[model samples]
Target: MKKYFNRFPHAVRGITYATGNDFGFRTQVYLGLVVAFIVFAIYSPLSLFEFLFILLGWFLILITELQNSALEIALDQLHPELHDSIGRSKDMAAGAVLLAGLFLTIVLIALLLSRLI
Candidate 1:
């Protein structure tokens, strides 16, 4: 438990570094906030839990992206060569984020349409 608590700082520092240095990460953060606000403002009255689910999905994608970025940076530092396995690993991580985003987008569109109708 103590070890895990101690490691929290490092994880937070990594997230901070990524948020500051990665343009894509920053864009996603901004977009997530916007989507979150829109969801809460428009959907909360109907279903707070559903709005929370959407926010959770957004956080999940952002977390996965940060982890992916960390892994790619570590792999690059270890060896900058065009390694096939490393590339595949990075791509798979990115694919997770893409899939999550696609699902979330569909959910948002459906929810918004339902709300309007």
Candidate 2:
């Protein structure tokens, strides 16, 4: 337990550095917060399931963004010079994040329409 607890500081430091220095990560976090606020405001009387779904969607987006940033940083450190394969890998990582965002958007829209109509 002591050994496990010792790693907490390093984990915290890594998260702090990544979120503080990464533009994409910060942007996604802000966007998620804004969306959460809008959804909660518009749908004040949310059911348990609806609220859970909203939280899940935002969590998925943030998870994907973190993964994308990690992959890009690792690739950059490994291959400072631009290469076709590296470019493809980065593109795929970005695509994954975009797909997650799109799915979240669809879910949000459905939720909003369900409430409005």
Candidate 3:
């Protein structure tokens, strides 16, 4: 039990650090706020499945952004000098976040259309 509890502070610290320092994390949070407002104003009383789907999409975007941030930070620390492979690695991480955001956008659009139409 003590062993399991020991990890909580580290987890909290990581979240605090990311929220404070990662621009992508902050952007996602702002976007999430906008989404929440839209949902409240335009699509109240969402169906359970619809709500769950939207939550999943948001989770994917947040998690991917966190991963991309971590990767970039790690790569930068490991190799401050500009290298072709390092650049490619960073680009791939960014691409992953972009894809996740695109997917979330598609899901949000579908949900909005379902509600509006």
Candidate 4:
């Protein structure tokens, strides 16, 4: 158990690096944090499913951002020169992030409507 807990700092460092290096990742984190604060603090009487859904939505966004940023960084390192294929790969990764954000937004909206109803 003690050995398992030692990896947290590495994860934190990764977060720091990503936050510093990727503007889009940072923006997603900030917005996700706002929604997270609202859902966890202001929202009331969350069912298990709703809580899980919220967590999953946030996870999906973060996961995609990490993937997208990592791809861009690696690709840039591998081929610093501009190329059409590399640009297309980056664009598709970005598109994935956009789709994830839309899904998260839909989840948030559904939760809000549920609270109202």
Candidate 5:
């Protein structure tokens, strides 16, 4: 248990570093919070299932952004000089983010449709 507990600070530090250094990550977090607020405000009595689905969608976006940002940061640090391959690698990471965003969009659309029905 102690060994497991030690990881939290490291995780927090990484999250803090990303929050400070990555604009896209920061924007997504803030936007997610705002969107969540709007959703709950609009639908005040949200069901547990709906709430969990929204949370999962938002977390999926964050997880992808973190993974993308970590990869880009590591690649940039290891190879500061510009190269075509590095550029492609970064693009692929960004593509992952795009795919995640699309997934969240689909989740939102599904939620909306379910509510409408």
Candidate 6:
């Protein structure tokens, strides 16, 4: 299990490939946003639960993006040519991430509103 866990760096390397090759600048921008929000949530008036939500949501986004990258790589390896099935699979993974993000947004809004009211 330790060996298996150690392999995660390689898996993350796959994600790094996407950031470095495809959208290095955009990836940096998102990273910056995540860091900024984390800092603000921790040091500002944000509740501990709010910080937890942000961190959990951030993790979900990262993992889903990594999974999508892995799927794309495996699909390319199996078939270099474009295919609808592969596209659908990737889209489905992205959709799941979007759904989670929507929930996270709602949680943040609700938590903040409850505090205010």
Best by TM-score: 3
Compared with the true structure, all predictions reach lDDT values of: 0.83, 0.87, 0.86, 0.88, 0.87, 0.69
Over 1-117, each residue of candidate 2 has an lDDT whose tens digit, in order, gives 999999999878877877899898889889989988887888888899988888888788778888889999999999999999999999999998898888888888998889779
* Candidate 6 least-lDDT 10 residues: 20-29
Q: What is the TM-score of each candidate against the true structure?
A: 0.84, 0.89, 0.90, 0.79, 0.89, 0.69
Residue 94 accuracy (lDDT) in model 5 = 87
State the weakest 10-residue window (summed lDDT) of model 4. Answer: 36-45
* lDDT (tens digit, per residue) of candidate 1 on 10-90: 988888998999876888899999988877786777577677668777887788788778888898999899989989988
lDDT of 3: 0.86
**Candidate 1 weakest ten by summed lDDT:** 44-53
Error of 2 at 79 (Å): 0.6
Candidate 6 TM-score to native:
0.69
Worst 10 residues of 2 by lDDT: 10-19
Whichever of 1 and 3 has more lDDT, that candidate is 3
User: For candidate 2, what is the lDDT?
Assistant: 0.87
Candidate 2, which segments miss by more than 4 Å at Cα? Answer: 1-3
TM-score of 5: 0.89
Model 2 RMSD vs true structure: 1.5
